[model samples]
Target: MAALTIFWDDLSVETALDFCEYLVRSEDYKLRDLAIWIQGSGGPIDELDGSIGSLVALWSWFKSFREQGLPGVPLGARAAYSVITGRPLDSPLEEGSRLVGESVAHYVFKVILSLDPTAHWAVRAKSGRIAHAWDNTPGISMDGGKHFGPAVGFFTNYPDRLSSNYHNAYAAREAWDDTGLLQSVELLYLAGLPSRPRSTSTTESILSPLLRDDHVGSGHREEIPIAQEMPASITNNGPVSAGAEELIFASVGADVSRLDQAAPLDELAVASVLAELGFVSADGQSVSAVTLLSHGVQVQNVDGFALVETHVAGGRLRGLFLEPMRPSEKEWKSITDAFSALGEKLPAHLANER
Candidate 1:
């Protein structure tokens, strides 16, 4: 069976309502089920606070259908509630509506078939049209019946068939500029269809010429392997050593102590250290705990002196760089509490650090 998918971009609540009305009024479309997936209360409404108003209106409309028995309303009260709350309803009617909407939105027109079906030819042909027109390319024929005009003719005449189908679908399904609601629906339908298999003779016909003795490996003839080449070594006999050997160690700011005996001095630690130093609390006190932690310093290693580095770009360290070395339960709790206290003051500290 064929399916259909409809999509609307940046459509306001008012527009959606009008669309729903149109669908109901139109005699051509026999909508099996309909569901609306609103992004949020950001839809266009006349009232200043239209978000709340639209929800109320939707709710009222749904209530009217449930209580008064409106003639063309497909969604029930529970379905309406689910739409408002953005959650699934437990009831059967609501679940059906939810399934319909979600299926349409994500997988409505997509065709599924077995690996080798008896009616593959017709199914493949129908599916190919949907797939071909999915590219937002204008004028590519949707099927043999309709030709994509000059603007999108490139798709129809594309040299690479596979490349054309892939690109076409991508553009139609995802491209916002050229593809609108109708085109998206058509593309979705095409995608939902099953793929067909090529006849054995057809496959062999396309492959045989390329595999013929004269053309075999025409572009991939075997060649002798090249010998491995070694890079030239640089020789600097004049100054072999600068008299002093420098050892550089790189570690997270929190784990800098691990470098204490490995190197003479630590020049840079992870960026977290600087962020802690500049933190300020709401009561005008410096956030010492956050600062210390950011600088890769903790109560356990108070005596350790290490340079702190951070991941901040532009040659600066602005945040904490402490490592949690097998943190004890108490230490973890303390850290969490410190963060909770510091969270409120983070914005100002971040600005100052910047």
Candidate 2:
């Protein structure tokens, strides 16, 4: 399976590195000393150790953000209203900045920075911090996609891959930090940028003598490279490439260890497995092309992913069908094992699929 791609607002690499430092310190204070030792800041600001996983993730995110052509966007005025009302209509403004809703998200906790301010989707501040804040929504659109809300869009009008990336990142973090929630994030500003050489007389940094003076210049801007095809190796890339000899390997998150076990299977067999797994029923529409259902399930290519229903205990259950993506040569066993593993870790959401 392909590595999940997330669109991020392209910013200076210096800023990205700064953010990396913040990620390091936030995740492990011990690393703060290591960063200082390595002269990550060229001097000690706080305090550190040797680990650096969070820093690497942030740095990788910066590189991938440009590769994937992602941009940061803030939510609109009426999106929160629409999410709550279940209507397509925009909400009316109230008192300018506060969109009086219970349990609305804290803007800072957003996967991306919150840049817009609308009363309809406004969230209250923590107590004693002044409840409401307002600002203008800087409108930016690409290929006609919503900037925020329940259905925020991603990449060249792609179905929100950022959401998947966010989920995967969250899972990765959960795998890493088993203690509790890690908050109070630090962000890096774009401090150094590489510039094109103007003359041979240019100098270098004292910290890293190999570094170019132009790269650390006062005004530096360079076009970030694009890497849209990076996911081809692991992505089904539209089961369009399917042939009698080809097998689609559907993958969830960063786990693709089972992909080598792939083998081709027809639509009927795939559908039957889903049915047996309780993801779909025999009466449901026949599997063909990718089709989104009102029930939040989608049948796509030879490999598909969906949010399916599973009853747990006396109530109901909803879990991500990561199991479906793990197809193998032993087709029947793969299907059964997929569903069985899923049953072992069924998620607890009983509400209608999102």
**Model 2 CA lDDT for position 284:** 45
Residue-level lDDT for 207 in candidate 2: 21
TM-score of 2: 0.20
Q: Candidate 2 at 167: error in angstroms?
A: 15
Clashes of each: 31, 10
lDDT tens digits, residues 1-354, model 1? 111111221222343344333322321122112222211222121211211112233233332333343333344433321332233445544344333332222111111111112211111111221112122221112333332222112211111111332454455444332223223323322432223422222111121233234652324322212212111111112222222121222322323334332212112321132234332332333334233333333222221111222232223223433333233344333434443344343321111111
Candidate 2 lDDT at 101 equals 16
TM-score of each: 0.17, 0.20
Q: Which segments of model 1 are wrong by more than 4 Å?
A: 1-76, 79-178, 181-251, 254-354
Please report how far candidate 1 places residue 191 from its true position, in Å: 4.0
Q: Each prediction's Cα lDDT score?
A: 0.27, 0.26
